[model samples]
Target: TLYAVGDWGQGKGKTWTRAGGVKLAKNGNAYTGTTTMTKGQAITARLIKVDANGKTTWDEIGDVKATADKTKTVDLKWTNAVEDTVDITINAAADLKTGETLYAVGDWGQGKGKTWTRAGGVKLARYGNAYTGTTKVGKGNAITFRLIKVDANGKTTWDSAKDRKSKADKTKALGVSWTSGKVNEDGTIPDDSAISISGKGVADGKLSIQKGNLAELYVIGTQDATPSDAVWWSDGAAVAVSGTGTVYGVQTGTAKVNVKVGNQTATITITITIK
Candidate 1:
């Protein structure tokens, strides 16, 4: 639409006509002509209609009340001028279809197709067994772990899903895994690393007798210079040598060895007979 200064009383003719005047016609979606419109003037315009299939018609769609006189190109200078530019914004959850007229009026910058600046950042949270991170997530964002399932043994694997590679990026993440050897409920050596030794000469043997007896006490271990400590318990008392761990003495009957460290503990037994 276009407007002129002062009250262009001569409407619909010379003083006010379509885009190209009576001889020529406007082609675009919309066009208008206006005389100097004062603050109180009823600013109105006509809408060129179109059918569902794309048709134009000389029909009145909508209009807006112009702001005070001060809000204009030259203020009081040009009372009635066709406002050519107006700001506006169009938001659509889905794509825009046909025959959709998103319009605005009043002052400049009040038209469709205006862009807006969004504020704030995105958030993420866990939903059931899965997680959903929102777009625009912060760089150093973190979230707590919450488990909702327990194993058949009534034990929950909490803290097992902790992040391992501190330098890994979650955006382009490929995969994640963990490393933990399975252990028995009683904390015994897993069958995989268990040592099985049996023999009459080294196992079922006599250690002490009437001064003329010898016990073939079996000693099975690494010949490494650094010998692990040997821990042996007689009855209920704890006994040891240079170091109490997994070592044996010259003679021995049925003896129990208890080893403990950290959060793990193990015990072994050796048997012997008198000559």
Candidate 2:
């Protein structure tokens, strides 16, 4: 359940009134409520969610168009406002253009993750090939993010590397080098997948296919790390992943596949679950 309230004006002229009850919708992760207000009130409203343990969270409602004696359905997604500080750095040498800006899109459930938007990206300051910025977050929250660069014209490109996860808090600067590929004659770099050395075991321990099914696993690699040679094999299945990094689920149980890329080899534990 959610508690709703409206606040208007301030000081002596301030007015506060109860909005109404808000219940969880059928789809879940959403709330619905009826708020009656005087037309053109210009009032600000908020919701306080009361959880099972009686712990309550506050969320402010965004702009909503309300009519006199009419119903309005406002959709909201919870976001912890960014208040923490952290530095981000990226290294790209394929000429990322002068106006292109690199941002770190993150918050894999660490701290309040609503800091970045697809329209504007992360709020990082660009310095040459690196970016520096910070957002205030709850203390000791683990933050994981991926790097994306946006050109002035709004064109965007993501780094080929996986999420840069950190155990320590953001007090320590975040850094990751670019895995950009060669530039084409049109002054455009290849896509992130093109730069990746397929089957770098990106999904190692992640997955491929279910039982009696075979699917190809993609490797997420950087340009600097060209793990060209890969040998795939399963522990018990007669079929194994060849140079294609494709695997088959021969048994209904779990199977472990080994991918040896250059000197480094990663073991992918696959659960052959067929629905």
Candidate 3:
């Protein structure tokens, strides 16, 4: 019998499994089995030989390395996995007022309890007008956080909204621009504004795309906004847009495309007509 082990296993103390055990081949020297794991993950397996009287012998230990097939969707197992420590760096906006202490609070240790009062806010250092800080969090898990400005009098004001990162890692860098704000009156953060889009190929607030064809449009934004701040989305099946404002007509139907940045949002309806 063969058993698989490592982070992919079921749970604590239940790490070993013979679920997909295989018998030795005709040569009586090799066996085969399969277990799915995420890309870049390393796993180990052991071959156990059980005799008639239940005596067990450990034969060989094999190391298995897994890689992802980008061409196909792979299921991920989240249980019994090790947590990686991720370092996060935050840069505050230029307009942050004086006497305000910048803080970082989220799902990690800085604010594990989810309450502002219990949140051990990590204070950022002031570098001229900008506040910066480096903090650690758990990788492969989201850290929902918001920039908070605490006045000398203990008054706390949150940024326009709470920003959440899906599966945070060491490579992520966050920027906080105090462009808009609403008091955390009820301890709830406001939603960030979306980007605005406009111009040619749009009619009556709707974009027209020929079925099985592609359409291009230029999105306009404020002088301070850059192309990197634009996020685009389509509400219908098969319709998609490139980061450079090029829309692909996948199927014949209507869809809504939304572009957002910070606290501004603009949406246009897409009408896909038969070619």
Q: Looking at candidate 1, what is the lDDT of residue 231?
A: 28
Q: TM-scores of all models?
A: 0.17, 0.29, 0.35
Q: Global lDDT for candidate 1?
A: 0.26
Worst 10 residues of 1 by lDDT: 87-96
Worst lDDT run of 10 residues, candidate 3, spans: 69-78
- By TM-score, rank the candidates, best first: 3, 2, 1
lDDT of 1 by residue, 93-198 (tens): 1111242221111112223344321121111222222122223222233321111222345442322333222111122111111122221212222343232211
Q: Native-vs-model 2 lDDT?
A: 0.48
Clashing residue pairs found in predicted model 3: 193-262, 193-263, 193-264, 194-260, 194-261, 194-264, 194-265, 195-260, 195-261
What is the number of backbone collisions in each predicted candidate, taken in the order shown?
24, 9, 9
Q: Which model, 1 or 3, shows the larger TM-score?
A: 3
User: What is the TM-score of candidate 1?
Assistant: 0.17
Q: Which residues of candidate 3, in runs, are more than 4 Å off? A: 1-83, 109-113, 162-164, 180-275
lDDT winner: 3
lDDT by residue for model 2 (40-112), tens: 4554555566788878676743423323432223334454323244332222233457888767677734467
Candidate 2 TM-score versus the reference: 0.29
